[model samples]
Structure formats: structure tokens, C-alpha cells
Target: MQFMKFRKIFSVALAGALLLTSTSLFGEGNVADAAVISSIPNTTRTLKSYDNSFLSVTGYASLSGGVKDRSSYVGTSYYRTVKTSREFLQALLDAKSGSVKVIEIAANLNLGWKELNLSSTEIQKYNFVAKYEDPTNGYTNPTLQANGVSKINVSDTNGLTIFSTSGSTIKHAELKLQSSANDIVIRNLNFDEMWQWDDVGNHKEVGWTFIKVNGANNVWIDHCKFAIGADGMVDIENGSSGLTFSWCKFGLEANTNPASDSAIYKSITYMEQKYTSNQLASTSLYYKMRKAGATPNQIMAYSAYHSKCHLVGSGDKDYVNYVDSNGKDYKDGNQRLRITLAYNQYSNVGQRVPMIRQGVGHMINCYIDDTTHMNLENSVSSFKANSTSLARGMNARNGASIAADTCVYNGVTEPIVGTELQGQDTSNMDPQWANLFKNAYNRNLIVNSQVTNANGTYTGSSWDNNGVNLFTKGFVWYNKSTLNKWAWSSSIVGAANMSKTKPPTTPFTFQYNYTEKLPYSYNAVPLNDVVQTVKQYSGASKVTLSAKDWLKTVYSTSSTPTTGSSVNVGSYYRIKNVNSGKYLSAPTDASGTKLVQTADKTQATSLWRIVAGDTGYVNLVAQVGSASKVIDIPGASTDNGVQLQIWGGTAGADWQQFKLKDNGDGTFGILTMISGGTQGLDVNAKSTAEGASVIQYNYAASANQKWVFEFVK
Candidate 1:
């Protein structure tokens, strides 16, 4: 599925922290001198070859100085095909600096998951308060594990393009590029099975990244699908620059959260039972805060879903300090972390769509939809400050400069952050939000909620500066830098209902005293076409397979519909397991009944009708079950081995909607749409007994996952 290349690379004129506690989330405060680079370039260097910039490498990756990389160009080499995990790793090892080596992933590669390991016996220490790692070494040394995490760690390896052939899936792993590595291209491959639960309430587990740019430079990542990782989906850190992410789909469904049996829940239960109140309080803030006001259930509820998404810089004081092999200092006078995110789609994300500390970004035509948040739907337009999604959409911190206007935002709690003033009145009636909005948010199309609008509609409220500065400037910064960037958990608990026409109070400022803009040019499509464009082209073409809907078939004649049925919806089919030849059955016609695999085909419970659900998915409604009863995971869990069940009153939840993936072999895999489109139903132990359990597991393509949906008359 080689994409014919459509337009992307929009204006994200670019651009954290470590705090661990039950209530004290990882946050940034009004402290510390802001990070500073030797120089801030007025404009980015322009690219010479700009033909068919659509889906092509553009933005900072196509240029230099505050971008990801220079380009993926360096001459061409015959592509070598790789099918297995080992072969995939070997091909990357074979890469050199002169000629670009193209590798076509031909198979669904499953790299297993891995926890952190040093590779060496040296004990690594972490300074939690200072937020620094590898303090003794002063050098960044990372071990590249081959399984479940295909790390890109080739030192000095410049030219490489890894593309998918419309069928391959690289999951349970990540493709990380270290600082010593540079000049790489990753396109059209789906990256999933990467997100996992951390030590509950204490988001201190800082290692999950689908594509971690740990100080890597000049990298072009396009057409790739990324799921939320524990730490971040794509983290650019350690002074890496020249990066571009175009035509990509990031985040997950609005309600995707950890199962009741997941690590977060288990951890909360363990901590609650293991430590007493005063004893636990004496040890950590996580417990102390929970003791203060938050209940264990409250902590688990708050800590369930992933909050952060794409991160440009790792932390506030995290500066670039690399000396290239050519003796060129990469730190003394380094460019800001420059990134471009155009024609990308962000759905149900919490925050940090390329949130940077000291970088410049240009985000062109993009679609950001976070309105589906459970909290938002219940709030009816009022935003709760303690909710993890309090801060949604793009943010700027630590003197970071960002420009994002040519985009559509829907139901974002705080559409833009790090650019606004914190602690305004609860009424959200204050005219002075941030000094940067009159220029950025003023141009964005924003709405509070498509489903939950209690206050009037609003958009330009969250756009503000992200850092606290010592140097003074305007109403706040003019000769008086920021007091501090707002925390992720905002304190303002109300609708940010300021209209676009509303003017800030007297002596207000809109322009920033210190900012960086890009020189690269890419025309944006009409705003009307943004949602359709990205949905049609983003992600690996073969995985979600949504690209085909826009690329060729059913052109513009039909728009993507908001799917679902209150009870019964579409066609009926009898689902039979490919392995055991057993039928997926539900008996007693009751809710909360665990679905089982049975040998009986005449049972009415075996029949299920498919109803449209959550766009590009379908709900399997049990024929004789309770009213509106559909197939669902007990806790809407993402973990393996969670038994499938029939539940009533789900209201076409995304968790109940399965992506019926055609196996190309007269069979299908009923995949969970929220598990990044990988985890699916499996016949437990491949059992052939009278009644065997059907549970969710990572997609293995084995007969257990393969099922034949027999059409019923």
C-alpha cells in the first residue's frame, strides 16, 4: 500500500517534568530558570526539491535548524525485503551513512514487550526530585532490545526508509531512535500493542514510547499509526532536531482505559492492602494524597486512561548536549526542537500533541477531536480541573514557540495550553486568558462540546504561553517573564467560554517577545476537507485499511458516519471459531453473562447482528439477550485473557465495537477497536471442549483468532 502521497506537514510552530504521587501528577511549576538555546533561528532552511510535497517529507525534517532532520535523501539503493523480527533488526544494522536503504516490511511482525534493563551490571540511579538519569555517566547509553521493541540505535546511520506493504503489523514493540542515530524514514506501518499500565497513580514509569526520538536528529516519520505508550507516543528529547510527523494518526478512542484487572487497578489494590494509612502516608505522596481526600477508587479512576500524547522535549531542564563525530558541538549553540505536524488526526487525546519545552513547530491542516472524553460528556460543557484531560490539545512550555491555526478542534477541554495565563476566574469570563491567543487560537475553529455544551461555545481560551520566564516582556512577560507554566491538572473548573470576538482587558499583548517561525512552505487544503483527508491517508494503509475509503473507493459520495444502534442494527451472522469449530454462544439471554465457545450450532444465542459503532467499527448484538445487549469486555479491559461478555445498556461503546478484520483466508478476526486494532477474541487454550472460554489476547493470527462469520438467513 504505497500511498500516492497527499498533502501534509502543517503549522505546529514548535516547540516537562517528573512528579509522582497519587494526587501530585507529573507537573511543571513556576520555578527554575527556563531552558535556553544558544540561538533561536528566525526561519528554517528551505528545501530545494519540493515536488509532490503531499505525503512527502516536508516541514523541519526536510530542512534544518529547529526541525527533526535534513531529509531522508542521500542517494538510493535497491530495497531489501524483511519478513521476520530478526531480519528486520539485521536490515537496520546493515544500514550505512551514504546511500538510502529501503526496506519493505512484508509480514505482520510481532516484537514482544519488554521492561527496562541496563544490559550492563551497572546499577542505574534516578534522581526523582531533579528529574535526571544516568548522572554518573554523563553520556547517553541505551540498550537496543530486538523483541517487542525494535529500537533504532544505529550510530551515524543516515539513510534508511522502512515502509509497509499494506499487510504488515509491527506491534508489542517500539521503534526508538537514539541521539547517536540520524537520517531515517518510517512510513505506512502500524505501531501498536505498545501502551501499558504503569505503577498506578504514580505515573513514574517513564519508558513506553512507540517512536522515541531520544536525541535522534533529521528523521522523517510519515504515514505511520501510533498508539498511546506509557510515557508518550513519540517523544523527541536530548537535543534532537530536524524531525517531521506528517499524515499520521495518533492517540486512541475516547473511552479507552485500563481494565479493572490491569496493572493500575492491581497496583492500587496492592498498595491499599499492603500499607496502612499512616504508614503509607509516611512513605510516599501517592498514598498521602489519597489519604487526604482521594479514595483508592478515585485514584484508580483518575489514573485509568492515558493523558499525555506526543511530546517534543522530555523535561524543562533537559537540553541538547551532543558532540557529533565531526567535532561539531550540538549543544553550545543548538537549534530549538523544531517539528512539523500537518494533515494528522488526533482523537480522544488528553494533551501534548507535540508539547515542546524549547522548540518551534508548524502545524498545518489537522483534525483534533477530544470531545468524546467521558468526563466531558458528563460535564455538559463544564471542564473539571482534577480530571486527567483537564489539559487537552497542543501546549507550549519553557519558552517554547508554537503556531497552530489551520486546524479544527472539537470538544477539547483546554484546546491549547502553556500559552495562556493560569488561575483566571472560575466563570471563564476573564478577558485576559493568554497574551498569545489573539494571534494563534483566534484562527483555530474550536468548540467546547458536540455532545456536552453547558456553557456557550468557546475555543480561544486555552491558547497561552507555557513557561515562566525571568526576563520581562508584556502584560505578564514584557520585562516580566512567566511566573510559571500551568499544571496539567488545571485549577479552573468551569467552561472556557470566551468568544473569538471578545477582547482581552486593557493593555493586553498578543505577540510573544521571543518566538521562532519556520520558513518551509506547504499550502493547506480547505478546512472542510481536513477531517476527511487525514482519515483517508493517515496510519499504515493495510492495518486500519481506512485509507482505501478515501484513496479510491466510495469517493466523497459518502462521509464517515457516526455509527451505532440503540439495540439492533445491521446484518446477522453466526460466528464460528476457526480452530475449535465451536460457535460463540451466549445463553440465558441475560446481561453480564460471559460469552462462551460452544459446540451447539442450533442455539439462538449463537446469532449476532452487526450494527455500526464508533465509526469504522460494528457492534455484535446478541440475538436473544437483554434489550440492547451487545458483546462487551467486563471492564472494557485491554489486557489479555479478559473474558468476553454480553452486557446491556452499553450505548454502543467503542469497547463493544469490534473491527472485523478480513483474514484474507475465508476467515475473520473480531478485533477490539480500542486496543490499537490488534488485540482480539481468542478461543481459550484452543480448547475444543463443550464450553470453552473466549477471551481477549494480542493478535497472533493463529486459528484461535480466526473465525468464520457464517451469514444467517
Candidate 2:
């Protein structure tokens, strides 16, 4: 069998020509005008119609006072207004008071105004005098602090909506959602400088995560901005589920110091001390010392136990083997956290854009512009012992899974680094865990450019224009067949070398046909292009309520099927006939028992697993007890009416492998590798009778030829 070849890169002139063609087709218009058009609602329906229509809805009342001197004991009547971070905490704590609450935050308001407005000396004095306190781990009553506030808790609250109207900024505060905080929405707010300062002056020693979703469910954070945190900007852990972060931005503010610097120093010093003293200490004690204003030498007494700090998705707790309320361990079911990150932008952020652990993540249409700060020099020093850099645009670690599509990365220059889309299982503890990374799917576009800001800020017009134009003109969304073709044809190369490789020119063009005029101008661009439309609204300023609503409409009504052409390689499934509700079965593990469709039953004969084969084909293995059997063509025949049967699986048998052609309507047509897509597996004579013979025949768009693989344990 011939494997697919590597893709070639386009020349500079060819790439420019293709970009120009796309621009002309999509109507070249000013981005500022597009931004204005995005703000206006496309439909005339009242704004209230969308109140609960989306998972994200904005319109919270602001509090009267500033950050300082704000009351934490506000009544339910004042719960709607959140003028200070303390009040915001109280409002969240009071979310359970009402059946359904909508707490609207004031737009263009800053929660940390008092601290931010203070002079440098005043800020230092405040840090010096204040006692550092750590929030309790699980559910507890709100504790009053020296600042006259309580530790914020959102445990056991449901049907809560906390949103910023427009252009609101929440600075210097951490939002913690733990102990089963469910059905929450936070959107359109900027979380800036949410870090705690050590007694001496270091702001990176303490845990000041912007949003921590621990043991929560059904939370949506949309169209928000996260910048400059002491730890992870957002850390979702402890079996959280149904979380989505859409059209958000994750990056550093201009000219700001990173928290990773302190984390690295602490890690290195701790490691040196551990090696010299031969004493092992709990990592938590080191954090305590740091918070208690330990000297450098005092901190050096501990080993570097916590190195991968100060990044997105850091400190992710294990979700496996979680015991539910009934004392049942969900080691294999309902224990992994699931997240969808769509149409977001990541720039100048450290590694873990994000690093998933014991969960699954789907990242679609994201833009990663730069990774200079995530290089080896800035990464955890211990990580450099084995690899050049610890940076990963998207990574799945310790049996986690990730699927990334239509992502674009530019201005990354690390050669000996981790995989841009990576999966690592170092211990090889479980056989299933060894193949977890094979579940990862990545289809990305890499561009070579030196786009940089001298001040390290991403807010100027130049940055905006570059980001907007790249989304509008330079990206392409591939169909299932095309994506599979590309995946098979191209080799998985590092991001540093991706710009040098070229792909087929046809797949680089947009999939939709242009007819109507662009939304903002008279120039016509393609309509019904889901990826392009979503990309147009990916930035901090462009992702308005109207844009988000428009995106929701497009996403809901689009005909795109979630599954691609390639079958889930490592997943076990039941192959059922679309015409007849029966599953394809092998009566025995013998070599020549004609395959037949049988009634659904809880037997191994009815279950199959798709395994990756040579040259981009898949082998369907029968889950018969202790039998290494696969669906095979008898006598290695390539005839049209040859029957398929279960036989002993060979290492590289072409006749046993099949290519699954996605019909784009939730069905797959199975074609044998021997026939080379000329023939497909069909129910004999199109009969719906039980025990009918399965045969290979000329390909046709018939229901008998289509199959759906229902996931089964």
C-alpha cells in the first residue's frame, strides 16, 4: 500500500495571489467599518428576545461605589448591581437566593479602580501592610477579610447570569467557582491584573487565577478578555463539564511583567536545595513560605516541585476515578471534563494554550499569533532537561484528548520543542492510555511573519488590522474528505518547519461560493461560510453581543456534521445499518462465517473498534472474546459481489482495511482498500431482512450502503 506524500508549500507569489483572489471575492472593505457593522443587530427583533436564547447573555447592573469602601453585606435588592470586586463576590454568593438571577455589571467600569488609581508608593504600602490569605479549598461560608470582604463562594448555585454590558473591566480579583457551581454565564468582561502580591512585592508567588472552575458544571465564559494573571488565566479542573469559552482573548497586557519569571526562579532554587539537602518537602509548604514573605535563601531550602505554574490550564487536578454521589466510581464514564474553545485569539501567552489533563478539548478556528514568551528561556527549567521548549499551542497529557481544526499560528521559532499539537503518555501505565494521543486531530495553517509590537501590547491599530485581515483573508476551512486527505497526505511536522511545507492549492481556497454583498459593504463575499463568519468576530473589540448572536445562529443552522471523514481511530463503536436498525455481526470468530446484520444485542460479535492501518486505511476489529479477528474479504477477491467475513487480523493486510467516506449527513460509506474506493460494503440486494449477506458492490448513494457507528462501551 502506498502511503500519502508530504504536502508542499506555496511560493510567496502564489500565496499572495491566492490571498488577493480571496480578498476580491470577499469584498475588500475597511476593518473599522466592519467593526461598526458588527455592533448593529442584523435582525429587528427586540433585545429581550435573546435574553435566555444563548448560553451567554449580557446586561448586569453596576454597583454605586468603587472597589474600596464597598459593602460586602449587600441585600438581595442590591444584588443586581456590582460596583466593587467585593460586591461582585457577594452577588455571586447570593446567586442562590433567587430562582433565576441576572446580575448586570456596569460597562466601562473598573472593580480595582482604588488600587489601580493609587500611586506606585501607595500600592507598595498597601501590599506591605495587607495580610495574605488563601481561600479555603471546598465549600465554606464567606470569611471577612482585612479589606472588609468575604471569601467569594458560588457553590450549589444554579440559573445564574453575571455579565458586563459592554467594555467592562474587572481588575485585580480572582473569580472562584467551586463545589458544583452550575449553570453560570460570564461574558464581555476584561479580567486584568488579577494577581496577589507577596508581602515583599512579588505578585507571582500566590495563586490568583482569574477564573477557576473546580467541580462545576454548565459554565460558559464568552467574549471576555484575560490578561496578566499570577497563575492560569482560566483553570478548569475536578470533573467540570459542559464548559465553553467562545470568542475570547488570552494574552499579556503591553509592557507587563510575567508571573512565570517568579515561578521559574522558585522552581530552580527549590530543585537545587532539594538535591543538596536530600530532604523532600511538601510543595504546599513552599507556597506558604512564599506567601509568608520568605527570603530567597529560605525559599531555596525547598525543591523545585511546582514548575509548570503561571500558564493556562496549569495545576489541572485529575478527573479520573471520581466517585459520584452513589459511591460509584466513574473511572471510565462521566469523569472527564469537556471543553469547547471556539473562535478565540491567543497572543504572547505562555505555554498551555491549553494543556489538558484527563479530559477532552475541541479548539476550532483559534488564532495563535506569537509564542516568544513561551520559549525555553521562559518555560519551566526542569522541562528543558529533556526537550528544548515546554511550549505547546494545544496539548493533551496523561490520557487527555484534543481535536483542533482551522487554527492559524504565526511567528513561532522553536526547533527542538514539543508537538504544536501534542499527546504524551510517559508512564505507559495503561494500554488504552498509550493510544490516547492518537485521538488528537489537528488541521492548522502556519504563516511566517515578523509581526511584533515594541511595547508588547496587542491593542494598537496595527495589531488589530493584522489580526482582522488574517482572519478575513488568509484562513481556509476544510470539509471532512478534504481534511482527511490533508491529514493522510501531510506528515505531522513541528510548527517551526510548517511554514516551509506546502499543501495542495485547491484545499486552501474557501469552500463556499460568493453571491451576496459583504455585510458591511457593497462588495460581494461568500455567504454561508461558517468558519470565515466566525473568524470575522474573534477579537476582543469585534466580539459584541450582536456578533455572538449572529455566530450562534450560523452555528445552529449550519449543516456541517461534527464528525470528519476519518473514523475515530481509537474509539469502540457498534456499526449499525442505516436502512435496517440491526448491527453488522460475526456469528463466530471463524474465518469464513458470512457477515450478517443481526438484532442489537450486548455481545462482542456486534461491537467493533476502528484501528489505524497502513496508508490511511482502518481495520475494523471484532470484539469477540480473546479473538484477534477483523472484517475481511474472502480469498482476497476484488470482485464486485465478493462477500465479507471475519478472519484473523493480519498486521498489514490490505483486504481487511477500509476507508470510511463521510457522507456529511451523519453516515459513513465503507470502501474496501482492495477495491480502492471503486466499491463499497453493501447489504446484499438492498434487502432489509435479518441475516442478509453483506457484500462489496459498485458505489452508490443508497441507504443500504450507509452505516452509522454508534458509540458503545
Candidate 3:
């Protein structure tokens, strides 16, 4: 009941349109130039425009002019104005302004830098190597001589901005934010192919994160495009807080390498067995053995062969931890990585959209579409091996608290339709793995359409309850209204909100003009549209942006609607009579007691559970002495003015049923089931005293017939 009190306290509004001058590039001009800022003080804000003028101008410069020497860098012959990737990275790391410095990238730059290669010692320092190598599989351990690395480490930096120039992309690089990187904003950039292949043509695992937020705070990654990476498009871990990823697109490449069919089959088999048949035997037994004094290597050997293999491109957890400064385990009171994932789109990407661990993630208005197994060769066959279907979507583990609100999950129709939500409780091994949805509130799981058989036949079953099963598994429903809210909000009602926005095409030009066709191309959508779409549906959309504006709106702090009489089935309530000014009371441990209106008291006898019954009626069960006894009319009395009593017997009997009709003024009339509901529960003689008896009386619509159900624990 205490958790149910948590409510959203922010709001957003669309600003009026403004006029601006358009700049031309290679004979193209007349584009929208005015920047629009939606200021929501102390909360996140959005600035929309082509140029970077909307951002802070202090210690900022354009890529071609003040930041770097444009003449020294060799630009492409076709697009001479575009800066090279090397020049961009150099200027970014070299910037020591001691204040916020913003670098607006001017062109689509190639991030292939062979000169900045790391030595083996440096590689080991970064822990960028796999401990074990599988000779038969294409998994080779990373070695400096055998692998190529190109990464830009933004270490010890504060107040930095590396946003894309309007219609520009940063290709083939990993933007790594080191520890203590704070107040950084990276937006509107397309990162593609930050990858490397081993000798056998297998993609290397190192340096694949498009944007890695490692132990950073106050980082905002908005309106970016991420695709064709060997690993995660964006990974935020390692104590990173106050991070927001908004209006970004994480999609697939046109001809990207699919997961190996053999490997996928093995992985899925391991997962299904560990989760279903063995009940997570590998993890549980490993911990048990460790407690029994097993060595680290022995546990590693068992995990390597028996446990589920880590899937690449799935958001991994190498950087997340749940430990304090003194090497103690973290508890519920520990500070968590607070992140907001809003208004983003994911298409055709592998699992972990994203794989969450040990954080409080507010996922609002996200559209995850076309999630499928990458290994199409054995996808159908492998899917059939498991008893259950496999659909890729958000995976929350390791005590992560995710509030997934207004999200749409459109499953892949081909092969096998998978589940939209997947979860496992690993909290027993560590105290931090306590409850996945312990902090979750107002989560609405929406499936675009019903999942069906591969040949388009209805499976006669549904995945509508998958979200509930995922978070509530191995844990109790913390706030009982959570399930009720999920039931009420879960539907395919918000698909139009995920429509893609059109980008301006007239003034934009591809920096690297290509005659030969490439394997993949970028699906570019406008940043402005993405921001607006997110702002419209995000949780913050409920409240006005500013205090002045919020005051203007009639916002209710109460979780319950003031006018609705529809009672939540599991919610607790205290019924009070209007005329008596007292609550309906029951005796302690008594089989039957003449129900009397007594002074309102904070005791178990005063609470009641509104158990739902057939035909929109409810049974009032007193919450005293196991709370199973229902308010019953003795002898099934049909005559008016018969006294009500609490009886421990079969519910749904005519004597125990009552229809609560809304008075439309925050009160309800309890119509009794006796005499075909012609009588209502009334205070005896319409008395205004504290000890008034309640009885089944003929309906008069008087003050004694009305009651208010106040929500209580």
C-alpha cells in the first residue's frame, strides 16, 4: 500500500512553431533552422533543430572551424567540407576547455583508425580479453596481435557534448566513456560497424559497444541511430546514474551476420533446461558448491559447459555490480543506477532490448518490433526443440527494477513467435538479486497482436500474461494493485504512436559518395520527430513542464480516481456510513456478530476485502482472524430492516452478495442481494450516533443508505 503511493510528478508540452533562416550545402537550402527548447526545470528537456545552436555556446565550436585545423586533415575529394573520423576523435580527447565543450560533427566520418591500436599490456589493463577460447567454435580469445582495436576513451571529462551536425553520421567506432565522466551529452549520431573479425572471420567481441557508459553520471544519449555492431548498440552499466536514452533507434543492418544455428540451438537448449526442467540447477548448484568450499576454477568449468552460454549482441553484464566500498553486498537501500529509457525504437536486433541488471530503469513509450533469432538457418528447427516458444525482448535480471510503461512489443511472425518479457531471479546467490519489480510501478505491457502458429493458425492460447509472469516469478507481487494495473493497461491500443518520422532530404548529402552498392544502408529518421513522439507518450507527459504550468492543470495526487466507483478486486477498504460517521466493524475471532457501526479504528477488524462476485456484485469479507468470513444476512432475510452479521461460510450466497452502485459523488450505495436487490444496506433508523446498527432496508437514496469506501492497507 505504501508503494502504491508513488506517482509521477512531471509533465511536458509542445512549444509553438518558430521561423528560422536555412543554410545551404552544395546548392541545397531552405531547411528549418530555428531551434525549439522545451524547458522542464530540474527535469529532462528536449532541444530540436538542425544546427547545434540550441545547445550551450560556451566552450563550443563547429568541427570545421575553431575546434580543429581543417586544412591539415585530408578530407574526402567528393565532400571536402566533411571532417575525417580521426580528426573528430583527436579534437574530442584533446579538448581541455575546463568547461562544457561541444563539438558538432560535420560529415559521415569513417572511424577506422589503425594508428591508435592498443598494446597487449594496455589490452589486458582494460580486461578486454575472453578468458577461455573454444577451438571448434569460432570463439577465439582476444590477443593484441590477432585483433584490431580502435576506441576513443572519454576519461575524466565533465560537461562535454559530441552531437552530430544535422544529417551526419559517425560510422565504425566505439565511444567509450571512462569512469568519472559526468554531465556528458551525445546525441544525433549514427554509429555503424564498430566491429572486428578474427582469423577465421568470426566477429571479435572486444570494442563492439557503440556507446559504453562506464561509471558515469548525468549522461544523455538521445536521437541517435545504432546498427550493425558486433555487440550492444548502447550499454550503460558500472554505477551510471541519471542517464537518459530518448528517441533513439537501435535497428539491424541490411546484411548483418546472423547467429550461428548450431550455437543458438545449443544455447536455447541450455536455457530451457536450466529454467524449466532443472530449475536453474547450474547457477544454484554452483553457488551451493561454492558455499561448500569449491574452488573458483571448478565452478567456472561447470558453468562453462553446463550453464547457458552468453549470447553476443544481447546486453551483457560485465560492468554491473552490486557491491559497496567495503566489498559488502548491496541491499534494497543501496543507491541504484537510475536510468530512463524513453521513446526509443528497436527493430530486428538480437535479445536484451535491453538486458537489464541492478538498476532502476524507467522504460516508457518504447516500440520494440521484429525481434527474431539471428540464426535463421536453424531458427525454426531450434525453436521447435524447446517446449515453449522463444521471442526476443526485454530481459531483466539481478534484482533490476524496471517500470515498463506504454511499451509496444511486436513479435516476429516467422519461425516462432517469442515471448515479449523474459526474467529470472538470481537474488539468492547475492542479496542484491532480491526482487526484480520491487520498485516497479504503473507497468503496462502491450502486445501489438495475438501470437499465432507459424502457418497463421491461432494457437488457442495467448502471451498476454507473459509480462506478469516475468516480473512476479520467484517473488511476491509487492503492491497488489500492480497486477490490477497490468490487467487494465495491457492492450494493443497504442501502435500509431510508434510511426516513423520523415527526415529532411533536400539539404542533406552523403559525405562518402558511393557508386558500388554496399551490404547495408542506414534507415535515417528525423531527430525532431523522434523527440516529439517520445514527449507525447512518456511518463513525464502526464504533468505540465513548469510549476506555473502544472498549477494551471487540475492534477490529482491521489492514485484512485475521485469519480470512479469501480473497485480494484484485491484492494483493502474501510466502509463508513454517512449518517453514523463510523465504520462497519466486526468482532475478533467470532463466527458471527451483528455488524455494528463503531468509531473508526486502525485495527484489523475495521478492514474488509472487496471480493469480486458474479454479475458485478461483491462480497465484503472482514479482515479479522484470517479475514475469510463474509458479511451475511442471517436466515437469508428478504424482509426490510433485517440486521447484518458476519458469517464464516460459502461466499456468493444471496445473503453474502451486495451490488455497490456509484452515487457519482465519491460515495456508493450498497444494494443487498435479498429480495432481488430491492433493499439497500442502511444505518438503523437513520441514526447519526456512533453505535448505529446496519440493516437491509428498502432503498430511499437517503444519507443512511450511502457509504464511502476509503482505501487502506
TM-score of each: 0.49, 0.40, 0.39
| Residue-wise C-alpha lDDT for candidate 1, range 245-364, written one tens digit per residue | 887888655432445534445545555664554445444544554545556655555443456777776643342344455756554111257687867887766677667654566676
RMSD of 2: 29.8
lDDT of 2 by residue, 1-713 (tens): 21111001112112321321112111244432121121111211121111112222211111111011112222335337566644554565566665335565654433333333445674453331122254333101111111211123467676566665333675445566764566666766776544322222223455656677775666777767776454567877666666667767776322223233333343435444543474533333334343345444433222111112222232322313345557654322222466767557665553566666545555544665554443422343432322232323554443343444334444332211222222322343344333333333333211111122221211111112422333223222222222212221121223122221132222111111113211111111111122233333433333223212221211221122222222344445778788887789888876677788988657888878665565336778776653467788988888888879987766677788887765645677888888887788899888789898889998895898998876552
Q: State which candidate, 1 or 2, has the greater lDDT.
A: 1
Model 2: what TM-score? 0.40
> Of the candidates shown, which would achieve the greatest TM-score relative to the real structure?
1
Error of 2 at 92 (Å): 1.9
Report RMSD for candidate 3. Answer: 28.9
List candidate 2 segments past 4 Å from native: 1-79, 85-87, 107-151, 195-204, 253-319, 324-335, 371-391, 413-536, 539-713
Clashing pairs in 3: 11-543, 352-355, 390-418, 391-418, 427-433
What's the best-to-worst order under TM-score? Answer: 1, 2, 3
What TM-score number comes out for model 3?
Answer: 0.39
Can you tell me which runs of candidate 1 are displaced by over 4 Å? 1-53, 64-77, 97-100, 113-152, 255-304, 315-327, 331-334, 374-388, 419-455, 459-517, 542-713
State each model's CA lDDT, in order.
0.52, 0.46, 0.44
Backbone clashes in each candidate structure, one number apiece? 57, 10, 5
